[model samples]
Target: MALPEVSDPQVLAFAAELAKNDGLVESEVLATLEEASVQQSILDAIARPAESKAWKDYRPIFISDRRIDDGVVFYGQHRELIDRIAGEFGVPAEIIVAIIGVETNYGRNIGRYRVLDALYTLAFHYPPRSPYFRGELRQLFLLGNDRLAYPIDQLKGSYAGAMGLGQFMPTSIATWARDYDGDGRIDLWNSYPDIVASIANYFVEHGWERDAPVTVRAVRDATARPVERTTLEPLLSVQQLEAWGYAPTAPVDAERAATLLTLEGPETEDWIIFRNFYVISRYNRSPLYSMAVWQLSQAIARGAAGDRP
Candidate 1:
């Protein structure tokens, strides 16, 4: 039989198929199908081509007015949670707070996408990573049916299906999310403890070095050899950086690898990253992002340590 061209039956069938694939047949899946009335415009919008530009779009979103102010308040409200989680995770509180600040404005702006809708939209319609989204959909289904949350009513997030305080993708939440609040549920959506611990956990899992520096402020000469951005991995030795006229303010006694980072600041700014700095990149994969976290971490630490930030 030919599949229906209309949205209703087609979406219902897709949801049923997805549920069957995940062993959630009968009642659970049929209920999902009952709600599967697709809006062609939303689907069309999803199918529309995405901009090839990355640095331009993603950067501006981070620097937006709402994000920065929300980040500040998030840091203030979660002061104790940040300190405790940081100590436990061996990452500094500022980095932890900065991550929450960056990802979801400390839970104030987690997202609005329904897990079912967003995952289904991306899993089957969005071709850029349909397979990945399909897997995430599976995870979301399992997460939902298992009462792993407060039902679908409270589970909303980003268009790509990331959810909760950290804006974690379903797979990331399934694997790395924790019930730090001791409430038995890993509630990243509303629990400050869970969010705080989850961010720190993500950093540690990605190899943050305890008590080691995340980045080193640096200076480079105008005559320095131009760096290939693709080769931004932290591999050049500090001595090599020195030869290129880069210096780290954090003080390393030689024999350490670093990456040269040029950032667009209110004024031009540069930083040389140590191994730990590279670890921060694993969280967001941007030098500017990592630097922001590091700087914010410094601010939080100073404030907590009784110094004015």
Candidate 2:
């Protein structure tokens, strides 16, 4: 077969960077890029992320009876491993299950796109995030055969190149992925121990607080004024928010630093989110995503405890 044309300056520069950083031949990197197929659907998917939806709409997608029930089952099936990893990592097992449940429905539908094609399409065609995707593409090459259980060309994942049950990106796999099975290989796809432990480790690395509250519904007083939120980090104190007329419906330490979130539910919903909530946001950086994971974890916990059907 004739080699695909590779004259794009960005692609050439990326190949050079990969070769320089990893000591791989530039021609080989260019050959790999040339073989990658650019899918327009990947570009389209990136533009319309589910996080764009309102809380009312987004909640139904991941918080349905089916999802909650399945999460309970998944948690039950992996209870031993989950509990062990949770205790070792100081992260809750329910939160770990919820992360997998939200990311890939407990590995049923991890993704459809070939990771190479997805990263290549976004790296070369999507100008808005080209630099980021390009960096991922570089990391994909760096991951090599040892770290990845599957060959690079054969790996499949989300449109943004997030792999396995947790939908972890290249950087996450490099930094937070664990070999819990002790097989000296990190397979996020088939190994439940690796998957569960990797997720828990990620939470721990991002400062997950053991036994701390993630978020709580706030009863907004009629006289409350909207507080401006510039960042997701928990910056304001619970006392400060209470003074501003947003009191947690549930009890929390008054001195705890928190941030207020206003979500568009049936009616506008206010939440006093804590440091643990911020840790969940580190996984996806969307309040809606973090909230969905939190709510799903709660529902799953309830179901597992025989509180819900």
Which residue pairs show collisions in model 2? none
Per-residue lDDT of 183-239 in model 2, one digit per residue for the tens? 998899999888988999999999998888889999999999889998778999999
**Model 2 weakest 10-residue run by lDDT:** 1-10
Clashing pairs in 1: 94-297
> lDDT per model, in order?
0.68, 0.91
Models, CA RMSD each: 4.5, 1.7
* Per-residue C-alpha lDDT of model 1 across residues 57-151, encoded as one tens digit per residue: 44565555455555556667776777778888898766777677777766667766676677777766766887887788777767774435567
Once fitted onto the true fold, the runs of candidate 2 whose alpha carbons sit more than 4 angstroms away are 1-5
Q: Model 2, 287: alpha-carbon shift in Å? A: 0.5
Model 1: how large is the Cα RMSD against the reference? 4.5
Best by lDDT: 2
If candidate 2 were superposed on the true structure by all CA atoms, what would the RMSD be?
Answer: 1.7
